[model samples]
Target: MTTQDLTNALNALSTGEHQNAIKGIKRGIERESLRIQSNGAISPTGHPKGVGSALTNGHITTDFSESLLEFITPVSESSTQTLKQLRDLQKFTLENMGDELLWPISMPCFINHQDDIVLAQFGSSNIGKMKTLYREGLKNRYGSMMQAIAGVHFNISFPESLWKSLHSLKQSNASLQDFISDGYLSLIRNFKRELWLISYMFGASPALCNSFLQGRKTDLPFKKLGKGTLYLEVGTALRLGNLGYTNSAQSSLRVMYNSLDEYVAGLKKAINTPSDIYSDIDDYTSEQPKQLNKNILQIENEFYSPIRPKRNANSGETPTDALLRAGIEYVEIRALDVNPFSEVGIDIEQIHFLDVFLTYCLLKDSPNMDWKEQARSTENLDAVVNQGREQGLMLNDNNTPRSLQSWGNQIFAQLTDVAKWMDKAYGVSYYSETIERMSMWVNDPSLTYSGRYVAKLKESGLDNGHFALELANKYKQSHIETDYSEFLKPWLEQQVEQSNEAQRNIENADAQSFTAFLDEYFHKN
Candidate 1:
């Protein structure tokens, strides 16, 4: 849809309506980190009890590795409230961490070796064992060290009221579930078409510890830094580039988001399909399972995409099963790199911009992506990640070629109108103000987080290890200096104790043998 079309639809949806689409924008953040010591090496400690049990805690959990702590905030409509909660979680976790510091960066700077990185250990329960086994499978398929890299997942969904309003505006005969699914699919399609814009603007990992390469051959023009750091002058996010979490076996997946059936079918096929390479691993017949059946995906979560159509699974239900049963509930955005500059890894401005951008994507016309368009998006993402800040950089906008600056300007121009409508609906100027400040990044690349970090590295001549250690220490001290919130202290303490009790109950209640448990889990497929 054109800009004018989206504006007309917004006007129609807003007329005689007491609710605003912007206010109903529910968002949650999942920020991941590796526990690091004062010297910036990955901490060998187990998950801290003060942080809460990884098994039962809804807010605090481990990602892939034991030391990699993931903090999740409950869904909130207000960006300020969401970020405050995230900060509170961070401060609480830091308080419980003792001498360990939260790694202040996305790309891990220091590591001992692959073997030094251990998979997260959940206790003796069948469910806990299954979770750890999944990580072990990932480690066996990829390497242990690769799973230790940190990033953030942004979970977002619009209110059903907003969707019903849109449905009424469309005068469609589709069921609510089908309508919502189709609408979200349209949003996903547009997101894929334009994701390079986000990568160029928000990408921050331009460099990383050289040890990440581990002798892999690459054509990237990398320059050596002090000690173990290697950098690319034009790189935007090396973490999103090559040396990050990826699955070669699953790259053949053509999970189209044009419709719910097609999307789910594609995912279903992948999870059921076997991988020849993975099948070679020796299954531990006498002992525990080494990896979940040598399928292309052990579960639906194994298929990595920048954005995912998510339906919160029921107890023991697979992600695909949930989507099939109840349709898409929300979307998970996995493209963003953790902003190292922010104490909590994200900020209000960025969240507001996403709200506006994603709203525009939904309102605008989105055609289904074909193979050619998908290939173009893949290439565009590579260009943005590798050399987005380079002068006169160009990306394909459909069949037409446009410079990054020109395309960004065009999007920002539309977003200005979107922001105005949001401000009017929400009765706040915060959205407009965010667009105004972020527009500067389009005109001046150096103002971008990645550009500034690259410049800082050049000036200081510090390796990734030294640079990140300094920031980690600084943030650690900052969190320490800030007084703990008296209001949240009791609740935080209760959550930790409650989660531990929940885990113990689950452990005590298990009736099935490990062999029977594994069989039942795979029966979902």
Candidate 2:
């Protein structure tokens, strides 16, 4: 589509008129889904098998490592096989973790591949003590447990050609800051509905919301609900959690500048020396201990630059104003855990539901709705989490309360229209089937396996640890209970063969010492 076509489509959605917004959302979902599907089913390289299904099972205690190891044993047998499989699983888990819990199946629009992302470091329980651990250098002293927080990374992507054209135009008449501001304004104007969709998705899941809130230090103004905190307070938790931590506005700019500088330097080097070996030399030397240290430091700088200075006060650099300056259009969703029950990290059906829900949020018209209305929506989300089926939430339309089931039905009805449009546009019959299956999950509570599992767990009164142990035992029994000797035979034989090959190579080598043989072996490879 031409830029104008895209601009017009976005404008239609952002009008915030009920029917117009629904039409715009329908068009956008179809277009975006088509673009992504054309690129290929987002089969990210590394993800644990069965993670999505496991999460749906509502059994949080299943050990991810056990299930992962089981899935790979049937596929390959190499010394590095286990490590390679684990890495892939972790990557998949991290990527699809947001599928069930957050809105908008796609990543945030502001994130580019090259943009700097940060993951905050704060212990699950004592934020204050965690700070103390870092302050007293106990992180180094205590090691693993002291460094308990998960680190999040941010990256951004943009249309490079369009960006260049815009940059050139700005240079003739405007400053860089002015150009960036104007560019973002245009981006928001075009993508606000999509952004709101993202916010709604993130806000829908209390479990995911807790991920951003439970581990932070913040003092923002908050709304309370009868001694229990409101969902907006959780949003505030994310704001405070990430304010000077993940995606610190100013730090990202510096990282971007540094990346550009590095890119320029590499370009200059390539221009000066046409030989392919010039780049290869750097790669070869990277393995050397001294060079490896330097490479590690560079990577750390690029990845951690956004939050490092704030983490270390002595660094004296202050955070950028980018986050505060921009309107709060999208909130990051971080609370998804890998489902141990699905063959893939997320199910295709669940992803389809996510698409429908996000589109419904974007298409819904009510920009003038007060904070009270927003709070009600947030409460509905919490009710879904805490007692979704038991105490069905009340959805508000223009300040009127409706049952959650009724609201869901209306949302799915819109999805049906989008599905019909997509089937016609993409010539895919499965599109309708996918949306239909998703609609069943919403309309028929019996199909909600996640909620059922939670109910079972509560009925059984099994604590998290015991429940996890039982699941892990089941996994072990499924794999290892079958003749142990037969299972180990293939792996052991492969290991023996590899060891013999290494021995032969060592025996034939002319190296004077073992260290020399090691160096030569690695270097040759």
Candidate 3:
């Protein structure tokens, strides 16, 4: 698109006229009673459970043993069965829950290697240890064990090859059966696309190395870095890994690399090749070499990796080995927190809004944008996270201070036009709803997840742990109300059984445990 064309599109979108559109859509949302009651429970102050103290000081940590196994598994080529199983397992976990502490810390998956490609996949709760412990048949056998390890979470990652496979599949006029069998492939592809779009918009660029971390010195300083990838806080990463994205960092990096390479190549080709149809594009031939390579590797290793180490030194796993094994590409976005109130990590409406916002970031011409803008954006993110919607917390824009609501409203306006375009292209009514929701958020920032969370904490008169407990209870209630609870029965049974067996084995063992057993079970040769 021409510069003027782009500018007009943005102007139309940022006008904030979609408020009425969202009000209409709100009728479709299934409303439930908001139960606000507090039971006295204190949130754990320091770090999440199951991670080392060294790694817990506000950075990502990993189980190197698990990472090593995952590296060889080729998790990207997971099948439809695997995806369904994961969804089912998650549903099951949501059922029969107590506090967050009693939940499984990680979502378990099995990875299968296919030459040059990996298929990382999650299992049904019935398949492994899950069947014995938490299932209905075994609940009495392991209820106590379940309560002790509630807050754990984990996830798995698949390879880029899987997306390529899906893209190829989409090209064909496949029958319904074919598509059903390949649904997981399609889901991953969509997820990857969303990730790519967001990464390009919010990721740190090599050019503005001094900005992302507020001028913190980077070991791999480069002249230019791309924007758009989201950086996960230490807490978020730990929670996600515990939830079951086993290869969260590695899988995320792969998606970023593949997406970025494609994006940059397309842009470079467009700029270089003369296009008679759209001849108004500017030339980038004068771009410097330093500005080109961008030292992406250095940025990934020096700044990003250290903050979220894949394995601990005690585990004999080095950051270098982890990156090499996982074929680390670009940085990954791990900052997003799933709204406990929503069924999915992100709602479909929010996804639609994000699409427009991300596209705008990409299509807009911002060659002159520098580190200062990056710094300002970082500050804005922090403010939104910690003090969002609070009185006196305003985001600064180009030296002018503006209320977050005003800035958000301006963004919503741009989003509205984008949604209209999408509605025409995709024929989906949801895009318009997305635009509406964006307006709602802008008009009342208190409706945001963060804002709601703070509010809930205050209203419940409980600490963080109790709030988490209440959320868990609500999720359980929702799960029981749905049809997916049956699938969880077997897995829960197995988990209970497994926990019982472990307890029995411990009771029979000598007070002084056998050194050989510990060596064989806990430590790798």
lDDT on C-alpha atoms for all candidate structures = 0.84, 0.30, 0.32
Q: What lDDT would candidate 2 get against the real structure?
A: 0.30
User: Model 1: per-residue lDDT, tens digit, 327-384?
Assistant: 9999999988888888889877789899989988888888888878887988898898
Q: Distance from true position, residue 393, model 1, in Å?
A: 1.2
Model 2 stretches astray by more than 4 angstroms = 1-87, 91-331, 335-340, 343-345, 363-369, 391-393, 455-464, 470-525
Window of ten residues with lowest summed lDDT in model 3: 24-33
Give each model a TM-score: 0.97, 0.36, 0.41
Q: Model 2, 337-392: lDDT tens per residue?
A: 22323222233344444444433332233233333543444444434434444435
For each of the candidates, the C-alpha root-mean-square deviation to the true structure, in angstroms, is 1.6, 17.6, 18.7
Write down the lDDT that model 1 would get: 0.84
Error of 3 at 61 (Å): 14
Highest-scoring model, lDDT? 1
User: Residue 360 error for model 1, in Å?
Assistant: 0.8
Task: Write the residue-wise lDDT of candidate 3 on 376-476 in tens digits.
Answer: 55455444433344544577766788876666566566667666755654456777786785577555545555445445544665534344555545655
